[model samples]
Target: MKFQDLNTAEERIQLMEKLSETFLSRAGKNDEEGLFPFENIKELKESGYTSLTVPKRYGGKEISLSEFLCLQEKIAEGDGSTALSIGWHMGIIKSLGEKNNWEESVFKDLCEEVKKGALMNNCATEPQTGSPTRGGKPVTSARKEEGFWIINGRKSFTTMAPVLDYFNVSAVIEDSGEIGNFLIPRNSQGLEIDETWDSIAMRGTGSHDLFLKNVRVKEEALVELFQPGKKGAAGWLLHIPACYLGIAQAAQTYAINFAKDYSPNSISGAIIDLPNVQQKIGEMELELMRTRHFLYSVAKKWDEANDETRSMMQPELGAVKLAVTNAALTVVDLAMRVAGARSLSAKNPLQRYYRDVRAGLHNPPMDDMTIQALAKSAIK
Candidate 1:
């Protein structure tokens, strides 16, 4: 059955609750063992979570960004990798719908599969250039040949490569100087996964190298690369914030629970009773609340907003990403401080989350760049 056939958020929410609970319980084990959480992806695939963002026009549910953000936060609270990995799809498909770009026939077919819950990934990061922010400058190039474009390049950190049915891979179209996206089906000839994701955190995310050797795709399948401030294409600014906020909330909860239960031998009662400990908890909570309110409000506002708001939206989104990701890193650090020596143990959740949340600060449109842009926009 398709996503639209499901009827309401109530049905989808119920499905999410059950799957999220089970995945949450197993996420730690999977992370520790360096497992890809294929089981969680399978669980998501079986449910409607994979199709949750496809628009209503083509047999999809058309849920609001507020709802989408909530879903991601909840899942992330269970497992960071699971939430982050699936985000590429949620953010992209919805943005695509908003643009209404594809030919009706093409949209119909992709949306139909999306309706039944297929997953797509943004295969943008290449080994040569860290991210598109520096300029696509794709090391990969596609040459038009024999009624099809032949693509060739290497992409590292291709998250969800194992389970993705479709990939929105970017490659430069020679002669035209156009940076376009090609929808390459998974396991296409010459496409292979190089399982090299032995990271310190977010281990459950199957981010690996994608090897593309003379891969061919039809011209219509090539999605035009979007320039910043463009009308169509998934705006990178919008998606980054949700992931950061989710990580922040997770750190806050972990700290709260640890403080309540941990009775440091030096302290009288539980650590919760200590004045300094209480202050740390208070500060952490404050950070989490600020991020939550700001993020939720942005998602809500965007839901009812138009493109003319783009100018203002840039700073707003950048601020949230900066605030929430930094908060998540700080909150996790505080949790470690509160937990004391126990926090460093390999068994500790705080240890892993601390490392994981820090990645957000470096994820592109660097905080410095965003701050600079905000500063420049301020005087105007």
Candidate 2:
């Protein structure tokens, strides 16, 4: 099941499909217990999926943006939580390879680790400051002391904290009053996970609190310095929409199956034959069709764009995320309507899909912010 061994896109997709089928079987138990899907992640790593995004120079596949989103959507169809938790790592690796913003030696080292199945995610959200996307400077503080940086503060929404090998943390530099992203190893001294994540949705993400008490690292740990919310266009963030789209697809499938099999005494045939159910199913399919075009078209453009062209696509990127995610929510809602009361049952997968789809609304590039940006873009 090595990704490198697959010669064609169909072959790669078949591998993910096989893997996702297994993930779907375990998804219910993991969601019920709010447990991290460690076994699912292990299978992905063992299948060589974890290293797919590392650059070819680093002995990895470095799949295109469109392909990456396609695979992410497949994973989400099985389990949104697992897809999201792994998407961060995949997208970050792809972005790092494309931008090469980090020092060459440092990025090379991280790529090597990624090739070895290491996982990482950015830790920027905080309880006091909120999402970094809103231009909130991190309350976490980093100080230069004797040629080393001392970091101290707690970060919220540290997703995949239990299994991440590295955390790219954002902190305000004490000496310069500037923000910096520090790449800290999981085993670093004075670093710990607080296990505080208790969200009703996306429970399998394991987005616990990260505590750094006098954590020290060499100066090279300072990876990038930038102002919050002003970073350049990130096409990688499309993974967010891809995840929700997959959940919507799963809900649609479940509703259709339920309709086809459940026949009421009043009806001569299955409920799927009823005009109302057919209308709802039609609407769901339309939403999926529209969103898929929006998502993949934008992804295709990003994959074909040069650095200069891509730099000016922030508005388009945000629009794709906003449009696709909202459409996904609509698709899921329509599916639930088709399923009726049974969709609400705890035993039904639609219930989990409903909650997980809602979580996408709260992901990065919030709906309000995206609308505001779009307004400004139109005016300009």
Candidate 3:
């Protein structure tokens, strides 16, 4: 379906369903070959999926947070890697536009580029600093030259690196030690993508390392300064949990179908007729429902909340990620159990789901931090 046909949420969903047919088919192959899903991303870009969250004033759809999460979950249901890869672009665009995080002229230019299928993501993690959320100054140093800032550092886990049009890199100013995110265009001098992504899960995401060896950009590229001790409620991160939940849903469906179809001479009927198998299915459904309710409710609440109300929701947001991700892991485990040892096969979708869902545990809003924040919130 053409993007012009997508005038409402339902139309957008229909388009996603159509695209998922191809994503679901290519998912296993991409995982096996450890290849990036370039075609899948192309489909998203051409279908205008990448621009869904760009502000409407920029001639884009500008879907709400809840709608964005819903679409993300839908894409993830087909391929976790594809969903996770693009989620960064969609979420960041919405968040940046809403917050006006960049200079007006630069942001307007970015929005226009997004409307024309441009994609971007934050490249914050470093070999030394790990997740930027852990509060370490970037070893990536930006030195002011005659009229530009020259950056030098290696950022790890630069998701969608193969297709990203922009890389918003975090670095400390060499002169004053002020930390900031520098917007580096993909074609900038001294910028390179090292094919270092070899993770066991989400292998198709192309989250390779980005090496900036004296990459220079105009000073206007330093979009936002980092305020170390302050943080706002980032509802856009709901995309992370939403992806895992989608993988869990896929696992659940696979197990159910396997139970219904797989039968042996030892049994009178399909395995699904067995009480043990039925129990697993029941548990998976319950967990999935709980996960969806927790995620969707929080996303809707974020949509309706003002800045003050949303700021206080940080704990709840962290809790949602903690709860939903853990629950997704459980659901996938149960699905694998229902599928038996065959699920461990290298080609099995369940195996892929198992590995992909586990990545969530390590994603930002780490479980330890979430628990600590919850504890602090409760005590106060």
Each model's lDDT: 0.75, 0.93, 0.90
Where does the lowest 10-residue lDDT sum fall in candidate 3? 224-233
Candidate 1 lDDT over 88-185, as tens digits, reads 78877887787666666776787788767778887888877776665647778889998898889988888887788888888888878777788888
Note the residue pairs that clash in candidate 2: none
TM-score of each: 0.92, 0.99, 0.98
Off by over 4 Å in 2: none
Candidate number of the best lDDT: 2
Which residue pairs overlap in candidate 1's backbone? none
Clashing pairs in 3: none
lDDT of 3 by residue, 1-380 (tens): 66656678888888787888789999999999999999999999888788888887777778999988888888888999999999999999999877876888998899889878899999988888866786877889999999999999999999999999999998999889899999899999999999999999899999999999989899899999975435567999999999999899999999999999999899998999999999999999999998899999999999999888888998899999998899999999999999999999998999999999989998888898889889999999
> What tens-digit string does per-residue lDDT give for candidate 2 at 1-380?
58779977778988898888999999999999999999999999988898899998878899999999999999999999999999999999999999988998999999889888899999999998877899988999999999999999999999999999999999999989999999999999999999998998999999999999999999999999999988889999999999999999998999999999999999898999999999999999999999999999999999999999999888889998988888988998998899899989999998899889888988989889888988998999
Could you tell me how far off, in angstroms, the CA of residue 279 lies in candidate 3 after the best superposition?
0.4
